[model samples]
Target: MDLSELRVEIDKVDKQIVELFEKRMDIASQVADYKISTGKKVFDKEREDQKLRAVKELASSEFNKTGVEELFSHLMSMSRKLQYQKLASAGAAGNLPFIQIDSIDKASSRVCYQGAEGSYSEAAMKKYFGEEVNSFHVDTFRDAMAVLEDGSADYAVLPIENSTAGIVSEIYDLLTEYEHYIIGEEIIPIRHCLLGVPGTKLSDIKRVYSHPQSLMQSARFLSEHSHFEQISMKNNAFAARKVAQDKDKSQAAIASALAAKVYGLEILEEGINQADSNSTRFIIVTNRKVFLKDAHKVSICMEIPHEAGSLYHMMSHFIYNNLNMTKIESRPIEDKDWEYRFFIDFEGNLADSAVKNALRGLREEAKMLKILGNY
Candidate 1:
């Protein structure tokens, strides 16, 4: 046959395929109705797997077999999504484990932050809750979480990630360890400075102190002065306080200008960080599982089975539902050799239909899934 004849035949097949798709979807709707009445789940992995194997075997060539598998996978996903939509409409979809609130009360709420008075977490808390909001300080990030768990504070502000240095691993692990829920987040512009007591000069500094992240962020500056000893403290503010109290002309700190001011120290060198636009993202966590009604972002962590295409199949749910995933990070699971947990940040609220469908699929496919937050 000529090329024109082949093209015509392909178009005719496409039309027939469209008609079959519609008919299949109509039958899927009936299945959804039966499932709803019987309180049955939307997804059945074994059944879908059997159907995919059967469809792939129908193809004569290996290439066509792969194509058929892909095609049926998508069709099955669509049918399952339609069933989920129907279940949601019928009020049969399971309830999410979070409570939606109109807003957080920042006016009278007590806030806690890791580090001393002038750390970035403190600045984030101030920016989120305002200056007049009652706040306290803790020596470590765990201490901050402890305050929240013990009902000593309404919210705890802790650094989750930095633009230059990547995620705060300790905080991520703590998120899994603790029951606190992240209700909000704030980003603070970081300006690492070399702070010292008044009349101290950069030439006289022999040792520098700050948080480990601050030290890494200022790695370029610290490398230039290899003669100086670098000491990692619990926080930059605590380092600044140590320098101010010690009255040592040979000791300096890499901390925020706010820390310098709070500790009555001078900025001997400004903008010491490697990147000028460096910033840190901090999360506002609370003991109660509550989220604001207008939250537009969601964070989740999941562990998928160790099988070929498992991760791909899990992510396909988000793509099929048109959910935009913003960030994904993997961390090694403690004591589980060669296994990891993936933390994902996606742009959608729990109240969204597409988000609901995606979460439903993820929960079904992944070995474990946890909704970290909706904010």
Candidate 2:
């Protein structure tokens, strides 16, 4: 066929594809109507998962695999929207938990975060609470908690873990030290970038600066260059500012890409984290106890007697109650010389009967036990 004829045919196919999508959406609307009549959810994750798996399996071209998965994921999101809209029109989806409306007021809320602006924790706070937050700065996690304890702040943000680093031990220790609850959680995407003073050249870098966590994340890129001395700062943003103010062109900072942009520092390198999937999980702590949403994580600490099967017995208690323990860590009791304290994060909430039963059993079998927070 001639090029003109072929182009016309391609345009015709594109038009047909658009029409087919509209028809599919119309069918989805009908399904939503039926679901509303029967009291059913607008979104079914299992069905969406199955459809995505089938579509991905049919993606024959290696180069198009990611494109196809992304395309379908977007389509599934749209499907949920169309379904919910239809159900909402019928007064069904409007009553569902997933269909949310209105933003909560944070105008008077004081948000406490480690470091100044451009820090990951600060970014996390804004992401969770937006500009409505009156953000306060803290030099350390302990200081942030102290702010909340003193009623200087309404909320304190702390990074609990990273996909690459596993866990932040200091943050976990602080969680046990303070009386607070994890009211909410956010996962920040971590992208370590090398930042230097505006006029600084790569050749002029004699020293690198960053928080220990940032340095650890960018170890690979920093380790290869032996000429640069790595200096650890208390926070990532503080390091960025130090580099920005430093007269030495050889001085650079390892921090978030956002931080480099904020400080007007040149990015020597980007995506310096150990893994592409690296993310830091932050929890919002509030001194005032709040009833957690049904889907929430509960953290508790308990001490088991120093006996042969005492630890084993605790494990059995969790098993008997059919509770999944997300995390379990033991630290030496600060002043007790050799005794140990256990910190655990479990799947169920304090309101769950099974969780309560397991805790009761643990308390009966052990010496000291505490339900840190329900959230």
Candidate 3:
């Protein structure tokens, strides 16, 4: 056949495919209605696997076999989405476990933050809850979680990410380990300074101390002073306090300007970090599973089946529902070799239909699923 004739054949096949697709969707809606009355699940993994294998067997070529499997996988996924929509319209979709509130009662809430005074966590807490906010400090993130668990504090403020150094991994682990939920978040600009005892000069410094991440952030400046030994402390504020207590002119701390004032130390150098726009993101966590009514961001974590295209198929839920995913991170699962848990942050409220649809699909397919929060 000539080129035009071949093109005409392809168009004819495409038209038939579209019409068949529409017919399949109509049947899927009927299936949805049946399941709604019967209370059956939308996703059937064993049935999907069987169908995929059957389709792949019909393909005569190896490459075509793989393509056929992929094509059917998408078709099944689309059908499931349609079924979920039908289920939702029938009021069969289950309600989420989270409660909604107009706003967090900050004035009456007692907050807890990790690290001592003048640390970045404190700054973020003060920024979010006002300077006069009732707050206390703990030595570790776990301790902060413990306080929330025992009802010692109403909210806990903890840093989850840094713009320059990346995420605070412990915070992620703690979130999964504890039953706390993130109610809000605050971003604080980090301005690291080289602080020393009063009247101390740069040349007199023989040792530098700060949190490991703070030391890393100021690596460029610390490298120039190679003669000084770097020591890691629990927090930057602790380092400043130690330097002040020891009255050691030979020791300096890389911390915030607030640390210098709280410890009564002088700032020998300011803006020591490499990045001028360095900042840290802090999350406000509470023991209750409640979120603000106007919250627009949802955080969830899940573990997918250990198989090819599993992750891709899982992500298609977001694409199918048109949800905007903002960030995704993976953490190694404890005691599960070669397996990881995925944490995803997306723009959607828990009350939205699209969010419900996506969550329903994910809950049915994923090995495990947990909604971290909505804020």
Candidate 4:
């Protein structure tokens, strides 16, 4: 359409949109009444899934699916909010207590972080909650999850992704398996600084330790420092601790400058990321869902049928639905050779009606689908 005609058409659409939105709001109020009478909860997974499937089955083309899902996801999210407002007004889930990491006393609220004291995940937790938060150390990701489950810690900090390495499939898979919610995220620059005890010269160092990604970033430096043998550790921070504890000034670690300071080690070298902008994304997970004021991202994991154009056709659902995808990653499905599970992180809250509808359609079309979490 021409610019003038497009403007006029958009105006007309806007008018219709406002009208439909009002109508949706009215129906949402009615839904609140029905739910109250039936003693039903605000979120219904099965009902929500069934609703989306019905929409997809009725959709004829990708374009329609895109537009409708986008429109409906927002609509549904708003509708649910309105319904919640009504329920709250009637005194349901009233005066619930919410914890803010900042407000919580660092000395009181204990936390679990993966790896020993010098780990990147620990750095992330300290960044998010400050050093005052007494941290329980863990050896592995599952151990961190276990701490939260066993009530040993109120929350857990763990790395989700790295800029170079992309998505950490292990974290996403564990998200589904663990009883926790990703309440917040932190991005920490991955500076693989060379660390050792103070007064150690570069020539004195004999060994270096770091994670695979860290080792990869510092490959050039390692190659140049022929005297030092590179040792692979589970993580950068752990390497720092190992190097700090080692009595030999000849041994060092490749970790962030922060880790070196935390572990009482000295930086032998700095700026190790092949790209200076290296960063790792970490998440703050808790035992319960977070009542996020403005949900900035939505995370979903789904599966597509083993048919021609299945992936392409399903992705169109996101496109047609008008959701801006931030990330997409695929993992192999166990016992289902060649079959994969996909994780998609996108803009907009899942509470929106259009997103809900689009997802409903997607679930219907795909062999398997799951909303990993929405935060």
Best candidate, lDDT: 3
Ranking by lDDT: 3, 1, 2, 4
Off by over 4 Å in 1: none
Q: Give the clashing pairs for model 1.
A: none
lDDT of 2 by residue, 1-375 (tens): 999999999999999989988888788878877887888665565786688778888888866776787677666555555564454445442211121113335677888999877799988998998866888788888899899999999888889888887887787677778877677788999998888877777788888888887788777877788788989998889999887876558799888877887788888878877778889999888876564646456677777767544576567667756788888888787887777888888887655556655665565456777666655
Candidate 2: residue 232 lDDT (0-100): 92
Residue-level lDDT of model 4, residues 234-272, one tens digit each, is 878888888777758988888877787788988777886
Please, what are the lDDT tens digits per residue for candidate 3 over residues 245-315? 99989999999999988889999999999999999999999999998989999999999999988899889
Residue-by-residue lDDT tens digits, candidate 1, 135-171: 9998888898899999999999999999988999988
In the order shown, what is each candidate's alpha-carbon RMSD? 2.2, 17.7, 1.1, 7.9
TM-score on alpha carbons, each prediction: 0.91, 0.69, 0.98, 0.70
Q: How accurate is candidate 4 locally (lDDT)?
A: 0.75
Pairs in steric clash, model 3: none
In angstroms, the error of model 1 at 164 is: 1.3
* lDDT for predicted candidate 1 compared with the true structure: 0.90
Model 1 TM-score, all chains together: 0.91
The Cα local distance difference test for each model comes to: 0.90, 0.75, 0.94, 0.75
Tell me the deviation in Å of residue 83 in model 3. Answer: 0.7
